[model samples]
Target: MTAKDLESLLTIYKEVVEKIDLGIHVIDSNERTVIYNKKMREIEDMDIDDVLDKNVMDVFHFGPAEESTLLQVLNSGETIPNVKQTYSNNKGQEITTINHTFPIRENGVVIGAVEIAKDITKLEKMIQENVYKKGDTRYTFDQILGNSAALNEAIETSKRATRTTSSVLIVGEIGTGKELFAHSIHNGSSRADNAFLSQNCAALPDTLMETLLFGTAEQAGTEGRPGLFEQANGGTLLLDEIDSLSPALQTKLLKVIQEKKVQREGGTEDLFVDVRILATISEDPIDAIAAGKLRKDLYYRLSVVSIFIPPLRERKEDIDLLTSSFIEKYNHLFGMKVAFIDEEVKSYFQEYNWPGNIRELEHVIEGAMNLMGHEDTISFDHLPIQFRHKSSSSGGSNDLEKIEGLLYQPDKAILPLDDYIHEAETYYITKALQHHDFNVTKTAKALGMSRQNLQYRIRKYNIGKNTHS
Candidate 1:
């Protein structure tokens, strides 16, 4: 061919290569980049001058995965098709690409390879659309309402913690909404779609706890069951009241947390698991250890990222928000049109110590709504007995005297008031004692008093005549 004709042909070839959207590169056998098109420069957000003649490895880091693919293609002198890679451009933006590399031949001898890479970021994003959208419910950050600094900090910490893979331990008093925080973490996590399995350690018996946590083998009378751990694989597992777990079960749980594996009952094989463990303890694990109820090693493992939920009394500012929310919920559930709580009732709720926390508050509002008979508003009359007593006790020195003055009054007046006061005290104390099944420790907790104080009262009032020592 004539020189002019050859030059024109070469120009035409260059134009066609430049017009192609896929990035093209020719690398010599030594893995040195030789020729590259403008598309390659554009995709990498780099100038041709910065990349040409440079060793491919020197120009870009292929990560462990892409490096392996490159090595295979180079050693085999064959095409490596559809090798996916994720890399950042010069502008520091992540991009996904599907790369194809094939050996180049010169006179039947492999000289180098031609690499073509097609941008697949958009395609990859479309594939992940469902995963990205998972667990995005109607709830948002605003749904967690509390002005108290401690609660605000906990919420912020939870939000940040959601971005990590660390296990979380939530410790709080009973009814303080530990489960609520656990659900919030699950909903905000990447594994939210899998499953959120919760098990109350105290509620399950030792004989069944293992079967409930790890699957039980199939038997003649019963179908095989996948326990909470198995069901929560690739998701999250919430162990509520972790401190209440039996010592033997605690050992088993520690093993699972350490190994990320669980052995099903009546099965020899161990199953791999990928569940994120979240545990809660109403009682302090340290105290549990002192009481010989919880294993120290298990406590340490579960408490890797610990969160202590302040009691309602500690965060009194949140009482209004929590009460309002409960009022709305119970109003709907009880078929009540209650739109607002009386200001006095709100004050009483805010001022009174919520020993039972959010769960107790919910029950109180439910009870009030039921008593209102679907009234449009909740007033002081609808308040629970304890709450009403709290309001009355705060009225003035006169009301204060009714409680403290009982200790030192004339025998004549005391004779009549004593019976009345003692009757009221006995009623509540008996109810609390029964509610906690005569466990003095728990009854003291429910009554917001020390065990010693409760013991004294029980003795003074002559309660539990049949059981008392």
Candidate 2:
């Protein structure tokens, strides 16, 4: 072939090599880079001047990985195909890729090695973003509202817990806002910019749980998809109802938590994962251990910073505030202005024991809101039948007799006759309500007043403060 023909052929080859999207590096057995392309520079976020005609190892830092495929291929005269690698280049840009590296041989002798890398940094980033909503920060510390000493102490502890990467264990009854604490902690942490994932340990079987939490290897040429751990790489994972895990699974979880790495199913390498583990359990820790439901070793590792959430009944002082907040929430939702909760209704709420905690109270209020018609207040008549009977059954005729005998003359009679009559009328109205079994509808008729007038008087005097409707 003529010299001009060879020159034209060389130019065509250079254009083809430069246009390939994958990063390509060709190094001779001596380890000096002979061919470097624009696509390679783009993938590594470096310039051609830095890597062109330079030593391959000097331009790319490839340690921390158990083996370097290109370095191995150059020395062994063999092929290494589709090996996954995660490392930062000399330019300080982090990259993850699948490399097809092998030797280029001539006359049955190894001449050089070529590395073609498929960049996966973008794909992994996309997976992380998928777990979280772009604009939605679901929960924050401000959302958890309460003022009791126990609740306030827990809140302060939770705020401190968010600043560290240590494991957190939230202990509470079923509906005492364990999940809310989990979300708030994640949002408040440095991992707020990354993903946040939650999985209920009881929601899946032990075998399936392993695959879902650690990840599964994909079929054929595609790479394995990330699991909850990989997806929440730099963020938090709430293992809700973690006591439901079997002892076998508990052992596995302990290893993952300690190692800070996960070995995917059908995949050989242990991928390093920086995930914050936040776990929730409903049972008392001591009782759970005695019952063989929660493993002691696993609990020790997870409860590095433990938080105990008090039940609603224990924080009764906040019941009035919570009721008002829920009322406002429903008012905007249902387009109804529920002015207040009746005095009789508040009394019953204070006396009853809330076994199901705050969640049950919210449901009870929501039920009353749905049943409310034109009335602006939530009365005992609007309560669910079960809730009404909870208080009425325990209260009986003794309460009425106490009110009847409560009528007492003022120390000094008021000079204004109208004011005196009003004071006396308020007292008589209270007696009539107790006589009618604390039923406002029945009491109004017996007192020869309209139902609206009886309600007005009850509010005016703050009457029936201790009555159960």
lDDT of 1 by residue, 223-329 (tens): 45566677777888887778777888889889988999888876677889888999898887688889988788887887778888889889988877887888777
Model number with the top lDDT? 2
Task: Give the range where candidate 2 is weakest over 10 consecutive residues by summed lDDT.
Answer: 398-407
TM-scores, one per candidate:
0.54, 0.58
Runs of candidate 2 with Cα error greater than 4 angstroms are 1-137, 219-223, 391-469
- The RMSD (Cα, Å) of candidate 2 is 19.5
Shift in Å, residue 6, candidate 1: 99
The C-alpha stretches of model 1 lying farther than 4 A from their native spots are 1-141, 218-224, 373-376, 390-469
